[model samples]
Target: MPASSSRLSSYRLPAFALALLLLLGVGIASVWGVSSLRTSNEWIGHTYEVINRIEVAERAIRSTEANARAYRLTGHPEFRSQYLIATHQVDTAHEALASAIRDNPAQHARVKRMREAAQAHLVELRRLFDLQELQGAEAARQATNSTLTLRQWNEFDTAASEMRREELRLLDQRKARSDRSATLLSAIVVLGMLLSGGLMISLMVSVTRENKRARRLELEARGAAHEMALSMAQVGELSKQRHELARYSGLLQSCQTLDEIVQLSIDTIRRLVPDASGRFYLIRASQNFHDSVASFGDHLISSPDSLMPADCWALRRGQAHMVSGEEARQLSCAHLDTGTPAPGITSLCLPLSAQGTSIGLLHVSAATDAMDHGSAVDELIGQLAEQLGLAIANLQLRETLRTQSLRDPLTGLFNRRYLEESLARELQRCERRNLPLSVLMLDVDHFKRFNDTHGHAAGDALLGQVGRQIQAGVRAEDIACRYGGEEFTVVLPELDAAGALVRAEQIRRAVEIATVQHLGQQLGPVTMSIGISTFPGDGLTPEVLLQLADATLYRAKAEGRNRVLHVSYDD
Candidate 1:
């Protein structure tokens, strides 16, 4: 009986030791589970941070590109400042991303590639800026429009996308790891609870508390991830908008004429804002009213063909004026109020100005129910206004310069240089079409004797009067130039010798009867000797025609001062 009691005691000690070991194992397993969950949560957070940094970098890069383009287009100091700010932001974001992804070799390599691409893009932008400063906006615009710049931008975009994709992949992997960790921890707790009740009850309580905390953290992480996705989508949309704006701005800068500007603006505005109808009004040279040079969409039928500056609130105020259905108390532009707008319509009128001078107005309207009345759309409209203003101003300046270069100041006729160019071009056309062209050389009779008798001012007055008479008698297609001094040349396209003779006689008679007044003193009647030369009959080339016509003018002067003479084909 004593031996039996001793054996039972031995079995009791072994059982107690086994129970102790099992408790220790469960405690160690719980600790390991908790640690694993914490590591997983940390990794998930890291992944989110990396993704956020990548997006920030991408946004900064786009901002840099946009502001750089703006600087090149307008050459405004403000755009340069904004560009610098955006470039700094890009550097900051790149550094942060690099730091965050240093632990991942593949991600780090991708970031490196992104940084290189970004640097290349930045260098290209710097080149454009320098070009704008040194060579002018047109030169910079040409550089910006090059395919190399676009390709570099694409490379940067590709690098950014790759980096973003890599981060997203890592996020997925980390999230999966976190899920596995959570599942394993939950399973361990359940098995421990089943193996032993009393010891595991305390462990279960602690683990349950931990599990609740972990689940709360996971929910927060998921919410943050969802929000991040939404932010990324918004960023992408904004990026696309900026890209389109930049591309269109480049195109606008390259436009050479007002007609081209209007056509391009119409197409761009329509494409960018498909839901809206709009009109572009330019202040006419008369400065009295605005002419609607272009209109788009169905709603434009209600718009006027022309409007006074006072008709537009934007023009009158020299700022943007907006009116929505909700703002019934707002005063709409006279131009718009005259038209019947759709119900619940929103309209925006932006004054187009450059260098503090108002040049035009851009009017846009849309039905509120059919479109998004957001700040983004308004911002885009504002940008369009600015771009259009600069383009139009530049075109006007170019045209003014070109006209000054080509026209004679005193007579308002084309100069010798323009005459030569036109004659050459006309000769080419005439040759191509197998048509005849005529050249007339008209000289004021006794221009030096008249000056000596009546003083130089009277001679000038006589010459001016004769030039006016000649211009008034020519057809719309005729090209007239003050050949040099008292000599004038007129090019008549599609005119044979018979037609040329009749035109020359009319010019000579017109000049003969014209009166001249200089400094309130009446001068004698002005007469000019007209000599006519025809292409294919007298000469084929402009130089030959001009020389032969001049010789015929000498013959006219020797024969009779006021009579018109044709080339003597008999010679």
Candidate 2:
């Protein structure tokens, strides 16, 4: 009995020790795997930042060059300030780029070459400035024709391009490595749980065969616990990512202007899809053109400025076109400027459509030719495009409705409703500023008889011509309205009685000399009667001012039709 007890005691110590050691090993392995994955994710984010900085440097340099040319030509002080600011930004951005790539020897060398070339280009720009100061603008212009400037720019461009390509290559490599690390982490956790369960069960079996049933149940329970913990962790992470996407999508939906929509979409989508470059094209239906309104990232597909409906295969087919892979090899879209696809870049043009109608195309460019898109990224881009299309379409409908309500159908002038609104607002404004506002009430002379002599169509044409003349003569801030049937009104702010009378005379004389032609017949010269009324001096309120002007207009017709009349308060 003593020997058997001793044997059991010896087995139990070694078994417990081994089980405890195995537990520690599993825990340590799991922790190491998770840490590796976190490190990889950080590196991937850094790579994206580096690539973005490189593109920023490219943009800054281009701006500097453009502003430098403008400053040399016009000698405008504002242009000089702009050139200085843009040049300063380029310097700051290059320094940032250099700092970002310090660890990489190859990248550091390329950035050095770019920096040297940029410095030389800036020196040449200053040379032009110095030349302009000593000599004239013509000499500066002659210096602008120097080959040395172009050569320096070309060298800088070449260096910048090489660095961009290298960064893109690094981005891909780092992304793959990050993905592998995440996969490895998950595998390690699962394997550790399995190993611990197996070891615990074997120890239970070796320690006692009589309690095998109970120990087997215990082993299964432990295994179930580990899996449950893992699943809960995964669920929590997925929920967090989903929450982020939902919040950003809500922001996209709330955007007001086309610019706001484009800027927000680019900012959010780039974070979700690293190393992506693309342009957003908005369809201008009035111009019958597809225009590039917004862009982000780098390596964009060069689509034309004025694109036709038939030019985009995506628009023609009513579907998205992937300009990479075998399916894309079938036909290139008309929007693309190339017959053959560029190497190491993936291009996709998805029509931004709402309901059953198409609006515009979203062209996405990937750094790699393979265009390997993760499911999450593809889903995000699709969601952004869908929301943007709906928002912009709604804005278009709203603008159309607003315009129709405010403009007259025949004369293309503001209607009475707009005139009333403008008058009320401008009166309040001018009253506060202590400025004068003038109202001109004018009518075509003998319109009833003229309409009967010509046809109603001719009268309408005559009214349109007068409306256009009034539009051309008034300041942009002034309001010209069709005051119903052959009558017109102009609301001119900051114009007193004297200025108003002068303007009314100009309109009266212009109408007296103008002749209208209908079909094969030429009518006699037309004439207008205009009455001017000034605010505070003639009348204060819009109602009083308009009434006074109308009364004066009647007096003008009574005295002589083709002359201007001023109805003063002192009268």
Candidate 3:
């Protein structure tokens, strides 16, 4: 486990969120700027409108003055009508100026002054006109030249000038202010554009980089997952291997022969390689061939009767052999049938070897479309072969040791030690079952005299013949042991004294009829004097029963050379 190579902490904000915030801020600034620009333009437009209205008012006043001068000069009724129209135009212009400047208190005051001056000038013109009409034109001219008229006309011109000048001054100030606002708005818009463009580019690049990073992270995560799956599979394989080895080791403890060991291996391998059929081929060293001793699961190919050493690739190569389905069809082992292998079939052959000597081969088959064969599976199967080989070898060695310990080499029957041990067990069993158990103590008649007459080989042959006869005469369930030199014992279970005597007579007759041939010389015939002892009637324990039976045999030997004799319990 190395540390991860990701730096997700460095990327706090996602690209979309950053882009959203940037767009929102740009939009808000754009809106605010547009609003500001519109307000500034409105103020600038208001100044122009106010200036135009003031100019109209000034023109109207001057026009009225001209009309009044014309009336005084012409002294006609048409002139009066023109003066009245001019007066109406002047009043309308003043009202328009007033309405236009309503929002500006200072400009409104200037409009108010212009209105008063026009009113006073109109009054003066009306009075002069009245004088001219009532008196004469000369009288009107005199009245117009009056100081009140002159002062009124001067006041009207001054007020109109003042209003125009004030409006012009205010317009200049407002125009300058609006121009600044416009400039600021333009600058804001331009700067905003540049910033937003740069920011947008930056965001785009960041998002691209983020996307790349995210994709890289995803790849790393996927790789890590694949690696983890591989690691888990390897771990599971190792655990199963350990468990399998342990289980086989335990099973080997109870196996007394190579057959049991092979069966155990077959059962285990079937579970380890699921959906795969397998078989164990034990090498018959003397036969020069391999035999299918055990098989488990299913296989694409059926097991054969036997395969020669050259028939297997694993045996020939002295190593594990593997073949994919396609490869197997081209070059499969000779042990398989003489037909084209199935498609999508996988096969593995492991040579079971121990101590550098190949003893057997393990063959397994699985479908190609199934699980992929990892190295771990291969290694485990190899280990299983090794374990199977070792376990079988160990059991075979144990069997050899066991036979040496328990069997008599001369007669190939259970030795005296085994007999005593078995006798004790039978006694215990008889006590539990409340059944009668009997022992037949037998000795060859005149064995010492025969050994003295013949060679040791002849005596050994004679003893072996007697041992075989006893073995053949007893029931399969009976225990026959070579107790000592020329003495044998057979234990019979669930038999009473009468039954024991009948079996003893049978063994006695078997010995009487048996012959021994040594060095091409056929000896006449042999006989055994048998002594019978039953449980509880003779003794309870094995030692006591054997002692009493031996004594009874001494009685039979005394009575005759060859005879089975049993003592009555009620003497």
Candidate 4:
């Protein structure tokens, strides 16, 4: 019996030793799990940062393209400045992305390809600008319309997409590893707690303490895992927002008019912020007031149709103005205030500015009592404002360039170039409709002698008055052009020889009665000779018709100064 007791005691000591070893193993596992979780969190954050850098690089590339195209189209100094800035941004973004992903060979290769594509795109843009300068806008436009630039853009986009996909793949793998680590840590903690329950009375206090510590570590790890998941979700949300912004910007680039841009902006904003109501207000040409170009969503009170620039705080301060909940009732713009208080409403006003000039305003409101107005919303607003501003500015610049190219500056009439183009088009149209077209050639009588006596400035004043008189005399469908020095031409569609004679007589009488004053000195009365030619009767081609009309004008000058002549008058 004593021998049996001795053997049992020996078994008890080894059992206690085995339990202690198990506790130690659990402690080591708890520490390892905490370290693994921290490392996984860090890697997750690194992946997100790398993704952010890639997105920024992509945006920079798009900006470079847009600014380059603008500069090519208008040759505006502001567009050039913007192009330089965008190019710099592209370089900086590429450098940062490359540095961030240097450790990954595959990602590094992708980035290298992306850089090559971007460099090629920039080189092509430079070539286009040089072509514009050396050749003309038409040659540059043709080059831009070619596929070479588009191919480079596509290559860069492909490379960027690959890089992003690879990063996301890595993120998934890392997340899986983190999940396994978390699961293993929880299992180890649970096993330790179960084993500690069987320990001897003398070891109970130490085992209990160790179990408590392990449970605490488990809870902390679970909390961290939750945070990491939330962070991943946030990253995904940010990525989605960026994609939406990119799509919106691409659409804006395709808009050719202010109205199109305004409508598109309203639709995009509504889609992006479903809970928000908004309006877009554009500054008029006179800069005196803001007109509401568009509005979207349901509001408690409709926004003003027009408001003075001073009525809005965003335009006044040239920045964003935001107010939320009860604060909105006190800080809202005068244009928005309906003298009624709005509860739980958030209002944001962002001034749309481009090239250091304020072009318009964007106003939005959302019921934010149930939702927070977080940084994501702010970021979206800022991006929308910037893209909309640039688009509107570029459209306006293009319109201005087109008008200047087609019209004469001094006379406010179509130039000789426009006249030639319109004459041919009108002849074709008249033939198509089985109608007649007329061309009128006009000359200022004794314009050289008048200039010698009254000075060139006075002659300019006389020409200006005659141009206005000619324009006023022509029908809305007729085209009046400053043909050259002391000469004018008008293309009249659907006008017969008789009709053109009457119109010429009217123009002649108007110019004869018109008086000119320059530098407070009244000049002599101005008179012009008119010669008319009709299509199918005079000639079929524009050159032939113009030649016949010019010959008739010489005959008119020989006969009398202020008389109208027709090509058929001699016949």
Candidate 5:
């Protein structure tokens, strides 16, 4: 055999040995887990028995007291017998609990106290019985109502409760211990998996190199081609799953509250992978992938764009990307630090797309390279991407829906409904947060005359184009709405009278300078008469704000056709 073949065979022997070692470890761990579970179950059962016995003792005490009272009043031997039987049960219960937790210090103390109290109570009660038997029952009963007997019964009840509480405490402690052990075991298993995977990857790489040295080029080529085919298949499956995951993620993001999003994200990811971490990366249209929305890992990168390899392989080549352990070391890659590429990061990056445009890549890692076993993991990543895509799309759709609901469909500006809702919300926020809010109500200049002259389609196109201009003119925080046909409203939060006036003038200037064209015909520039009002100055309430802004808009229209008017609270 050639030198390469000899080396390859030698490497395979060690690889097989490592595989066997791991198989043995997995078997032993499974057995250990089973034993631990059995022990935990026994502890739980023992604790429950202690609690049950304590309850029985309590019931017996109550029965004994009830029987003694009945025997005193009715002079019935049957009640007396029942009382004696009940009294005997207290001792039996104490014995059961003492036998169950004799080794436990806290449990022993509770059982000791309960047993002593029960013994004392039995002695005192028997004395009372003797007195009633020797003398008259009524005379003995009257004597039995003394503080001594009462105190003894109270002590007995207190001891029983103590026993019950102690048992519960022990149960909690045992459960917590079991939970910790299980968690530790899981961590160990995950660590072991990573170790085994690294060893296997190292062996494979060594064998491949040896084969090449031996000039067994055919075998080497076949092996490389097989790996490439498998990788491609994995990528295809990932692509399909990415679509599905995006839809689910979109649904999760639609919740009105943050708590819902958190819970949904967890559940969604859990379903995607049994024990996997998910990180959501948001980026701008820049090359660096700089912006990150949220991350869920210990060693999350501070900057997204700079962290990506500048070689541009990930973006330029749209392959389901992977970097092997050896390659990582050779390249001195950041991903291989911490004795592992970030947990769950065996490495795969899928590009995010929206409307056929690439947004960013969603990167996933696994505990070990072996977890990249087949196409299953890649497909899972694809599913996650799908959910994320749909989530983002839905959010955008929701925004559009909101715009449609609040805006005039023809004009593409905030609708009357949105105007009303925004006015109310802004008013309340201003009052509670002690911030200024303002509204501008305006009407198109001679809109009816324009419609008649140019036709409704031209007028509609004009409204749509003007709405875009109005949107472009305002800050993102400002909301512009179509109050109605030929009328519009703008709500500015944290703005005063002066600020509102400046914004209003800016909007008027932008509208005057902008012109609309339909079917290659210039329709000339459109303009609007504006009215402005400020919260607590113009009006404090929603209705008052609308009324003032509307009145100012009427005045501006009356004064001329295209002018801005400011309305004060008094005006």
Candidate 6:
């Protein structure tokens, strides 16, 4: 052998030795990888089984709780069926978990102890349920304390905790083996470094760029979450405002009479969202929206006759009709031309409906929409209008019922019931106000003789004529009711003895002057006898006042009728 052949053979022997060492390392690493994989797979299977068992246990607990609530609420036989099903499911869950963990030596050793504790707790719960059914709610509540619930919860929690531990251990082992394999591969790669070193640097740059992008995305996600929270808070505030508006609407609905409804509606609008001035307009039988009723800045417009039909675009549209700038020139009204409401005024008009008919329009004037007034404001206004319309309609119904109950249909004057009610109310008012109230009782003289001579139809017409004359002679605040037969009574509020005498004389004179014409037959002048009595000075009670007035009326009759007489009552 030459020197060169000898040197090459030496190099080959060392290379073969290094290759054999690498092969042995590869074999060891392969065995470790297989062992780690088997351990991970086993942990996965065990974890799945544990999860399945826990799910079953949770299902059983939920079903049991539902059945318990149902049985407590209804106490039905069907609820017993559900309760039994739930208890069976719980037993199955407990048994399945126990059987699955039987092969695990450590688990098996501790399970008996766990099972004993669990069984003890379950028995206590069962006894508690029985006691609750037999005894009372308080005893049951005391039995279902935190201890038993926590113990049952702990059973699953402990098993899940052990499974998590085992799973994590296996994962760690797998990771370690995988890391070793990676390290060996890295070493081999380094041994061949010069060929792929530039590619590794490029890969590292791409990874760094990706990490920066992920951090930016996280910041953006946080910003979006904060914005969403702010929007949700604003929405919550809007919901609160809407609820407050609904309350105001309900308050508007409870008005007892038309006048009361008007006062309440005005007050509600003033108290809530008061920036806008509102007014209600009633359409006449002519189908024209006219400003018959209105309240402005704490003052009510009392001119029932002053209102007339004007072509208002707002009312015609049945929506918000706003006119600003030069366009307002076409609209003619003292409210618009004088600028009392100021310029740039926006008007929202809602149509009032009662019994499916458009009755009128309600107009609201606002300076700005930023007052939280927009379409939502318009809808609220509509609801308010609807409530008002219903209240007015109810008031009308009550008035009709009241008239039917207390008024004489033929004369449109108060009947006997009205006389009684008026007397009671006047007595109460006199007591409260500490004022002297008087009643004047009047009776038509020779009415029956007149009816006998002229006929019953003439007598009824004469009575209607007397009713109108009396209504016109008295103040609007006074109440007039027809007593039985030809007698009538008038409640003279705030009137004392002298005032009552003056009113009684005025009524007598008016009846003497009133002429009744029936079927073109001119009846002679009619006359009435009047009697007056003062309250408190006479008697505090309603019956006493009326009786004293009635006595005085009989005195007027005894004094040859058609005269006024003052009645006296014993104090």
Tens digits of per-residue lDDT, candidate 4, 1-571, equal 2475456555666768877887888899999999999999899989999999999999998898898788778889898899889989999999999999989999999999999999988888888878987997678888775588778888999999998898899899999999999999999988986875576654555456557867888887997899889888868766776777888888998999888888887776766667678788888889899888888778643468898988888889888887765763456788876753377777778999899998989988877642253367666877899999999889989999988998988788899898888899989989999999999999999999999999998988888888899999999999999999999999999999999999999999988887899999877787899899999988999999999999999989999778999998964
| lDDT (Cα, tens digit) per residue for candidate 2, span 348-467 | 777887887778878777754224533344555666677778877887787789989999988899999999999989999999999999999999999999899888988988888788
Give the poorly placed runs of model 5, Cα more than 4 Å off. 1-292, 298-323, 326-345, 350-360, 369-403, 513-527, 569-571
Better of 1 and 2 by TM-score: 1
Clashing pairs in 4: none
- In each prediction, how many residue pairs overlap at the backbone (N, C-alpha, C within less than 3 A)? 0, 1, 1, 0, 28, 0
Candidate rank order under TM-score: 1, 4, 3, 6, 2, 5
Using TM-score, give the best candidate's number.
1
After superposing candidate 3 on the true structure, give the runs of residues whose Cα lies further than 4 Å from its correct spot: 1-264, 267-271, 283-292, 305-318, 334-340, 353-358, 369-372, 430-436, 455-457, 494-499, 536-538, 569-571
> Against the correct fold, how does model 1 do in TM-score?
0.59
Q: Which stretches of candidate 4 lie over 4 Å from their true place?
A: 1-234, 251-254, 275-277, 297-301, 325-329, 337-345, 366-374, 425-437, 475-477, 493-499, 535-541
Model 1 spans > 4 angstroms off: 1-231, 337-340, 369-374, 569-571
Choose the strongest candidate by lDDT.
4
371-447 per-residue lDDT for model 1 (tens digits)? 35334767887888898998888888988999999988878889999998999999999999999999999998888
The candidate 2 region of ten consecutive residues with least summed lDDT is 368-377
Q: Which sequence of candidate numbers ranks them by lDDT, best first?
A: 4, 1, 2, 3, 5, 6
- Tell me the TM-score of model 2: 0.50
Per-candidate TM equals 0.59, 0.50, 0.54, 0.54, 0.44, 0.52
Model 2 CA lDDT for position 176 = 88
